[model samples]
Target: MKTCFIVCPIGNEGSETRKNSDTVLKHIIQPVCQELHFQVIRVDQIYGTDRIDNTIYEHLKTADLIIADMSEYNPNAFYEIGYRHALGKPLIPIMKEGTDIPFDLASLRTITYATDNLDKASAAKERLAETINSFDFSIEQNEKENEPVHQNITPYLLKIQDEIEDLKGIMLKRNDEFAKQTVELAIEQIQKNTAAPENKFAEILMKEIANDPKKFKEFDAIFKNLS
Candidate 1:
């Protein structure tokens, strides 16, 4: 069966936002997916494993379809969505009305609803169901053929790690123990930050560093949260 991965911030216990998220899953997304024969997958639904683990990359890469909730402006959701977009797959962006849609993604279609308004939620659900029914998967499958399929996520991340090390090596020489920083410690911090408690900016910043090691100003900007 096809899988529909729900990418949203799992709220703390008893939080109103989480309660609202559960409502969307139960009344809006779940029923629609059930009728469409898609197995609904959510981070909270995973049992006996660290929910905040890097395995989220697996869901982003492999899910047949993805629905990302933009409410609360969750950074991890956006980060995971970025990888999904890079994979060239089908994604449905949804949000509660009044939530900010980032300018970069403003051009794409999105479903918006007033989470507190039952009528609006119901209408949004109906439209989303139709959208799911009419979705075209052929384009996504064609793109997926060009992307490498990884059975293990570690090796794929190791490639990123190598890039990180290469970037750090250059930085280390320029400031040999500048501020008493070492490449090993820097990588350890990056990996630890990326893995747990879900600090999305660190993950993105690390990727930016790996992508362009020579850009000191760029790293400075990320450090200052300027970009």
Candidate 2:
């Protein structure tokens, strides 16, 4: 079964914030997820000896769906939401009605709920269900490819890498050409200044280069790795 990871604030137990979270989980999220056959997992439900933060990160990356509650302006929740967005995965952002969404995330379609009113809670649940149902979660479909990171930043980074590779190749070729020309010029100058037999100095220098290939290889390597 597909998993839906919940990213939300978990205030201290028995506090009003905690009670609101419980109601949303029990009434707003779990019911709809259950009907859709999604296995819902939350940070509080996680159990094991593993570091909790690491475990939460793994879920944020690998979960098939994510429902991030923006209520309370919780820093942790917002950070996780940012992390999830960077992965270009499915994310459903929700918040309590009247809560102001940050400007950066104002463009996202966030489901607003009012747990104090039964009718609004019911409506929010329906909206959440509809949003979940609208996603094309088939094995062959990737509905979350439209995330901003994937749409813009990933391609930009890849393009930069490609350009860097191309530049390295050009620099290496130019370095090799320059080295060859410099050696040829030096050989020409030596032969002219020394009164050696015609082309004799060139032949001796070429023979020395052939015999000590490692020296030329080291020289080339130094240039290759420059910057």
lDDT of 2 by residue, 89-146 (tens): 6688899999987898765667889988999999888878877775666644243545
TM-score of each: 0.59, 0.62
lDDT per residue, candidate 1, 20-118, as tens digits? Answer: 889888989998899888999998777756555666777887788899998888898898887787776767788888887888666445677776788
> Candidate 2's error at 156, in angstroms?
23
Compared to the true structure, candidate 1 yields what TM-score?
0.59
lDDT by candidate, in order shown: 0.69, 0.74
The lDDT of model 2 is: 0.74
> By lDDT, who's the top model here?
2
Candidate number achieving the greatest TM-score relative to the actual structure: 2
RMSD of each: 16.5, 21.8
